[model samples]
Target chain A: MSEIHALSAGLALDASVIGGKAHGLVALMRLGLPVPPGFVIPTAACRVFLETGGLPGGELAGAVRELEAVTGRRFGDPARPLLVSVRSGAAVSMPGMMDTLLNVSSTGDLRAAVREVFASWTAPRAVTYRELHDIPHDQGTAVVVQAMVLGDRDDHSGSGVAFSRDPSTGERRPYGDVLFRSQGDAVVSGTVPTLPLDALATREPAVWVGLMDALDRVERHFRDVCHVEFTVESGRLWLLQVRPGGLSGRAAVRVAVDLVDEGLIDRATAVRRITPGHLRAAAVPRIRAAAPPLPSPDPASQDSATWDRAGSGSAMQAFPGSDPPSTGSSRPVTEVGSAASSGLEILARGRGAGPGVATGRVAVTADGAVRMAAAGPVILVRPHTSPLDLHGLAAAAGIVTTTGGLTSHAAVVARSMGKPAVVGATGLTVRTHDVVVNGRSIPDGAAADADADADADHMATDGHSTSEGTTGNDQTATDGRSTPEGTTGNNQTATDGRTTLGITATDTDQVVMDGWSIPEGTVITIDGTGGEIVLGVAETAAGDTGPHVDRLLRWAAEESVA
Target chain B: MTDLTVLHTLRCMGFTDLGRVASAAGLAPEEAESRLIDLAVEGLVTRVPGAFGGWGLTEAGKAEDARLAAEELDKAGARAAVTSAYTDFMVLNPELLDLSTAWHLRTVDGVAAVNDHTDAAYDARVLARFADLDRRVSPVCAALTAALPRFGSYRRRLSAALARGDLAETTESYHNVWFQLHEDLLVTLGIPR
Candidate 1:
């Protein structure tokens, strides 16, 4: 009991001993959430392990026995083997910088896995993370060993990461990524693209209800926003991890204001929960919604037709600088331009990472991006980024990753740089120079080749001179070749000597002017809040600074005056 | 300098001026420039024409670098050691990106904003951690260099970057150097990034 805390309802352990993650897990268990049965080898055990290079001598075996009893499965058995995950939980969270040994068992004497986790506390990256975050290196990480619920074991199984609300807009609903028949790793790594969290409602309704209930309970208990990682095994939900209060910027402000109204927390606490950092982030305008504007962005009120409208906008929705036009709400999806005979060309849609609008020439490779950026703003599109793409990412105006998700390296870097980014745009093929999106080749008109040249010349002449952005850096050309009835296929040439240039918008709500076969250098705007990458510039209004933001700031003003 | 050295330098830098390529390759600018010309003639390198133009590898050059890098690894009998170092590097990669991000933006009030570099205190803290990271990776770089001599340039380049407090996102800045070095490792190991 002194060295290990069994994860059950009423054990009050501080974060320093059990670490932030384990502390959160304990909270989840106490709240009656469906957390997997496990015991935490406290940070005290980790400290001793660090000094002696050994695990808390007998705590691991005893904990495993208890886990076995709770899960009703034998560890390392050939038949129905009980696999468990060992994760490092430091007092401070340094994500993606530590080791996790999953599927550990007794045959390897579990102690080795325990030691590995302990030793990982000082692995080069983890050490750097602590130093950067001002965390004391001496504070070790607690290892939480829990029985693994196989997310990929059956048809009704899955894994997902859910936020109490949309991290992008602070919308009060369970929003997250769900991977069916896969493990938690896919959900975290974002390498394998996942479905919207709502997909769970249809696939495994019971797990979905349990997850929704768990998110609600966690929000009520924390009195702030939170997210959780969970696995559904054969229709059974098992919560793996939970952390509270990660909403930022506008989302953070809205959540605080909403919570106060919901009477979860007092106005003073709500004001305190939001900081000036969140205000600045909120001030950053998001891409206007692509789906025809609903009364509000209520996912419940949305339908397949809404996505069709959002995805079908083929023309310029709004002019640049002036509040871009909104796609009028009355349009039906079936009446999309005659070109919509093929499945709607989704130019590119991904999980929006950082919030803002940017339009630029698409650069498929880092070299092309850096070179293209010198001429004008470049949207760096990649299958996925590695450390190598840093220079190109820096040079570009916005970032697009066909792979990776919110926490991927690209997402983290993009947010840090305050660059608008769209990630995990599935089915996007960055074909050398041309991009194939939503399974359609683009820019199939010979007339547009000469027009594209004229447009480029115009942009080169006018974009810098007439463009009125405060940043003084957006010289991205926004001309897509119109009148698209020409040769279509790979390497198709034109009537003229030049090749075809495609222009398309990177947006959520598709308007009429937008067409399937866009030319290159077509400027598309990426909205981080609405998670919309609109063609041309989507309208951007000032931050609503409405009741929620105003109340939060008023509380701030009142506190300062006090 | 050998043609492979010139071609690989261009490969690592992505697109860069002659001065940096020479420095990265440990050759005089003239030596690198002369070899680059020969590479261009061989269709392994191309000079982009524009304000942003620099000597860079063509597709042929990248294919050539991969051929020679794989050859170099096989000939030296160091694929196992280099591959092992790569595994360790991947572990550190995310944290490095995290550090770069912390440098680029900081949470102010409640929003993420660009770090204006006005806060010497904050910048210093980030730099100190960067130095600490560099210190830990030194041995890994040393191990790779011992296995493959070409990797020695990375340590020299990174150490020079660390000695200076310059970690900006410019083309030749410390972060970009580390980025190029990371690419060099992957290219040498024949791994797609």
Candidate 2:
């Protein structure tokens, strides 16, 4: 029971003993997909360690010997060292709440790492997470000590997150982020910018083919959509983690309907997959998305150096002459009426923490956001956030920050406060009232310069509110103030008479945060769910769900008999 | 020196009515008003006249509070201890927000629906966890109190909020008080928002 077991398809063990993560790995190996050879020190051992504060010792040595024999590597040898990552996983998933130590080689390192993982189940954060989620605190997590297969081993090596279907729209395509020449932690940390997942096809064809086959097998096995974390080492692909069917809302409907269409699952099962909650979430309004315009030839953008970096998809998309985004929620070859011909340009992309859209003038500093918000809707854009920025965040229509992940302070606060936010746009830089993204600066102030003074005066007098921000290009003086509502449209016209794209606010139920250098007074729309910040009211927001979503709705209606 | 009690109370509470400021400061309305008036006269405070009117710190007032708080921190020589306590509070910060969010929205079967608080057992569970969290938070509060006496008010306020049994739906609820305390620590330590 306390003895570590080798991870293989044949070794049947309860999740309580080996944990869900190791169980998933075993299933992947069973499906004839690649998983690294490793061993699991069981949850029973964790209970023992927690009680006595030490491992049984000899069992771990035996497990290491088995791993060494399987992988043909020496542990702690300077010439041909074998490394392991010690992680804590429970019967139920407790993602990222506990500690993990990677690249442990020495015996001391291994013991310390294992001890840390065992102890980490009771980490205050983990305890708090359990308290919120109603997971029992007493269940000690199983420790997974496995051989470290390097993701950053070579040019052909990288790590990625892949969904069997698009998570955003539930379309039948693999979608997620990929980081070349980086480890799994880099992708999780979100500190390193990641390329789109499709880059794998061109970079490593064999790995891509292997991944697709694995995705198909896993989906067929689970009879639903699945997501996996994978790493490739020197052209060899390996699956690290797998989970099935966490799709939600409209995406949930689309998946259920599509799976039925693909004959992977029956219609009754599709109906069962949806609950009343899915219907309600599907009803939430979204920002209509349009493909952002390629950046016009700016000298800095013309330089190949920026796009030369391996799979800089965002940067490549920024160039107007370059190819449209082939991956992500943005359509490559499949979707229709989603393309941008109206000259709307995307300045940056980040994690959408909040689920609605809003548009406003970009305010770089908290003081600026606080002051500027009085005049018009202001999107507070910062490098990162601190408690000092609360007043500014409170005042702003939406929030955008250059750094921090979905769980970062800015993201957490924004979601709790119910403001649409996009965080962790790595290349974003703010200067005064304008934001520069990927070396292509969106001079927000410059576009509004013609009327900056007047707008500032209007803001000071009228006090922009939610009601005032949503008035279309024509509505005026609703707040009983002389602030000109009709004048904002003037910023949309350039000297050449080609319409300069700017975000325009309209009365709608969706939440959008726009900081993409639209003219300060120009209204814009955003889809917080899709992490899309676009200029102008996206014409395609809610009125169009297409044939796929419509079929789901019809099927759901038939199923509920409600 | 400067009325640190009233100023710091307003600082933590955001824009609010005189009643909350007075109650939070452990003072009567009249006493709180007098202090606010004095602070207003010194250009450290201002009142907005509207349907949602309240007295709030002006730019000058916020600066003065920051300056006074920093000076007070140094004067008490409790910087290190207060910082240590702040670290502990930070570890509890996300959990605090999680509880608050759960109180507002229930994630059922992978969907987030507004929590009606109709389920007595669920509410009880949330409140019990809040109590557990409070027990863990007590030492952090005590450490802050050891460093700065002014921080003792937060301990009292938090305990009182818990006694009142507010999980959600109150501006001065336990969650809100804890939020303010979190903000106060950040502001007191001259940390960013």
Task: Report lDDT (Cα) of residue A547, candidate 2.
Answer: 46
lDDT of 1 by residue, A329-416 (tens): 1111222231133223224456555666687766555655665677678777666665445556777889876555444666666765
lDDT of 2: 0.64
Error of 1 at A25 (Å): 2.8
Model 2 agreement with the true structure over B39-140: per-residue lDDT tens digits: 999988776554335677776788899999999999999899999999999888777766765665565666654557798877787788788889999999
**Alpha-carbon runs more than 4 Å astray in model 1:** A78-80, A289-356, A365-377, A385-396, A404-427, A432-519, A527-532, A541-544, A558-562, B73-88, B108-111, B144-148
TM-score of the B chain in each candidate versus the native B chain = 0.95, 0.96
Candidate 1 iRMS, in Å?
8.5
Candidate 2 chain A weakest ten by summed lDDT:
A302-311
Off by over 4 Å in 2: A51-54, A124-128, A131-139, A152-157, A190-193, A202-206, A234-236, A289-431, A435-520, A527-532, A539-562, B1-3, B6-23, B27-70, B168-171, B190-193
